[model samples]
Target chain A: MKDVYKSSMLYDFYGELLTEHQKEIYEDFILNDYSLGEIAQERGISRQGVHDMVKRCDRILNGYEEKLHLVERFSKTKEDVRRICQLADSDINQKNISEIKMIAQEILDNY
Target chain B: MKDVYKSSMLYDFYGELLTEHQKEIYEDFILNDYSLGEIAQERGISRQGVHDMVKRCDRILNGYEEKLHLVERFSKTKEDVRRICQLADSDINQKNISEIKMIAQEILDNY
Candidate 1:
């Protein structure tokens, strides 16, 4: 989950719970990689305002993550899927493949 | 990116910044989903000790994420990869497939 799109996915999953302005700025700055100054100009706000908004939105998102741990759970599931895919890509034995598939299914079921 | 494996990946990528005890307990509790009592007993610490270590480790992990944003970047890349894979799986046009491939390559280059 240390990848860019994964970050955006986490944000997208939980960011909707934030304020509308928070969501907008976060999507632009974080997901789209818009500069703080660019976001400020686009939103007709000061650069500091954009920065503060992003910081606040980050706090909100991370706060939810700490308490709820859904993002953590989701990330672990993704890692398991990647590991299974990797195993399958390699020449794994049938028993190993079945185990990987079972783990994948368990993860999918939980999600 | 909100998947469990993704979360563990993020933790694995950055958890090293924490204390050894912190890392051990966190991996077991979060990644392996060991109970607090279980981790505490295994580590020869009190239940409260395990709880505190996990909380502290969580703060440390989230703190790094806030300041550095590496996990965020990685998560976004994973999402882009998944999106491209999905598009490839579907009957996307040549132009779109080329576009997706280009995007995937760009992502791979960054990682």
Candidate 2:
């Protein structure tokens, strides 16, 4: 259901590793929301050809994320930061707040 | 310089992506410090074969790091944390300590 969203995130993390042509086509489809027909015309390829290339790029990016897990770990760290921020702003005890802040800071420092 | 050390660090970041064969051979060479001839005998391959495979693994791991820079960024963040700890311990102003802590915390959270 969210293949495109996940692909784009993976692209953001590993797009530099892709070939130049792959970047252009992937960006057009994922970032620019270009239709397959439009990409085909722009790249001087058939619509089916464009689709295949896009699929190839998807596999490439997904493989990188599978090995790296950069996005998943990043999301978890972000959630931790959010929780710490909320705790800091709440009417919590001062000692508890500092303890929570220290833990959150440690999580970030480790990453 | 320090190719073995660098290779081991890269392996720590991306070794899971390699094939089973690659993992075994690479571990023997880099982690176990086995000689090329020893790995070749243990794996039932030639010395030259072991050498080539180890070199290939190096290239593959280095390629991943080049694109992701996970280790480079991790090292930088670690340095920031070190500075924060040092500043906190030093006879610095409380205002300066909190400011440095906030900046370092932000860097970790973003990462």
Candidate 3:
């Protein structure tokens, strides 16, 4: 589930690289959750065409992911941030909030 | 900037949607840091072709970003994770570690 979210976010970030046909099909199939048949009907293409396009697009998305590992990096960064936030919110720690703030600042600085 | 990182991650995630030509240009321009002229020379295309392709790809990437805001969400999640980790690390906080764990679990649950 998280992977899907991460992938979607990645998709949002790089979707413009797609051709028009690829974008239309992806928007319908992935983003809109339209079925193959539904997308085929909407686009006036065969269900096979829709399926092939979706699969091709998926391969392209996954290819970039495999090579770059951007989502994984983002996920790690997110985990780091979450840990710091929890520290800040904890009542047991007062001084730690400053530390957490520093960490957050560091992340932001690198960001 | 974090935005650039986020965008890069997103690009990595969704880059497969691009056509082969688009991917080649993108890999060169964005990932490989080749200038438009360099990319054009390498691809044996005009500099204008390289420039136009890069701009078009940027638009497509930004378009998905505008609609989905995946990188933004990922960034927020990362911040939350960092906070939680800081809480766990603090010596002043003993019980807060458990709270931090809970938050991490919650994020994971939803993740």
Candidate 4:
């Protein structure tokens, strides 16, 4: 379940960068939860072929994440925004306001 | 100048998805401001080839932005963060604090 979640998130972030065929097969295997044999029969390819393509697509998506870290940065920014919301909810004071400003600036700086 | 800025931002966000050769040529043309003829001479390719590559890179980057809107989202989130900072800098009140929370939630929601 965790692997599925991570694959979906990675696909959400980088699937567009994949080739058309890769996208179709990967969407089936990962997003649609199609079995390898199912995808193979549907695409008129061997199960091994489907498996290799899925692996290649996973590698490609992971490579993009490794290089760009878009997903990582996004997760960090979301956490920071949550922190800001928490600070805002706590107390309306000078220190909390300053902390909010600091966090907001960090988000702007692509934290 | 404006085009350069936009190009750099797009490239910064999506360039890692491009091939290494495309990255090199694109960095030269868009980021380094290298002329097509110069790039062609340096790369031992025709000026037309260099032009086409740069244009293709632009299209690819723009397509990613069009599909994913990462760069657009980043800009919007940055603006929201700036607003949060401004609100924090101004008078501290219940209304302003709530506004900050709203904006922070907006950021968290991937605005």
Among residues 3 or more apart in sequence or in different chains, the pairs in candidate 4 whose N, CA or C atoms overlap within 3 Å are none
Encode model 4's per-residue lDDT on A13-110: one tens digit a residue.
88888889999999999989999999999989999999999989989989888988888887888888899999999967899999999888887776
Q: What is the TM-score of chain B alone in each candidate?
A: 0.79, 0.81, 0.75, 0.83
Question: What local lDDT score does residue A98 receive in model 3, on the 0 to 100 scale?
Answer: 62
lDDT of 3 by residue, A2-80 (tens): 2456557657655656788898888787787788899999879999999899888877777666765656666665576
Could you say which candidate leads in lDDT?
4
DockQ of 1: 0.03
Candidate 1: residue B9 lDDT (0-100): 64
Clashing pairs in 2: none
Count of steric clashes across candidates, in order: 37, 0, 33, 0
Model 4: per-residue lDDT, tens digit, B2-53? 2898889899998988999999999999878889999999999999999899
User: Any runs in candidate 4 off by more than 4 Å, and if so which?
Assistant: A18-56, B34-50
Score residue B57 of candidate 2 by CA lDDT: 94
lDDT of 3 by residue, B1-111 (tens): 124454466676556556788888887877777788888888899999888887787777776567656567666656765665465456555576566656656655554
The CA lDDT at B38 in model 1 is: 92
Worst 10 residues of 1 chain B by lDDT: B84-93
lDDT of 2 by residue, A1-111 (tens): 337777877887788888999899989999899999999998899999989888999898888778877678665655654554454444445453455446555764555
| Candidate 3 chain B weakest ten by summed lDDT | B1-10
Quality of model 3 by C-alpha lDDT: 0.67
* Regions of candidate 2 where Cα sits further than 4 Å from its true position: A1-5, A82-111, B1-5, B35-38, B44-48, B81-111
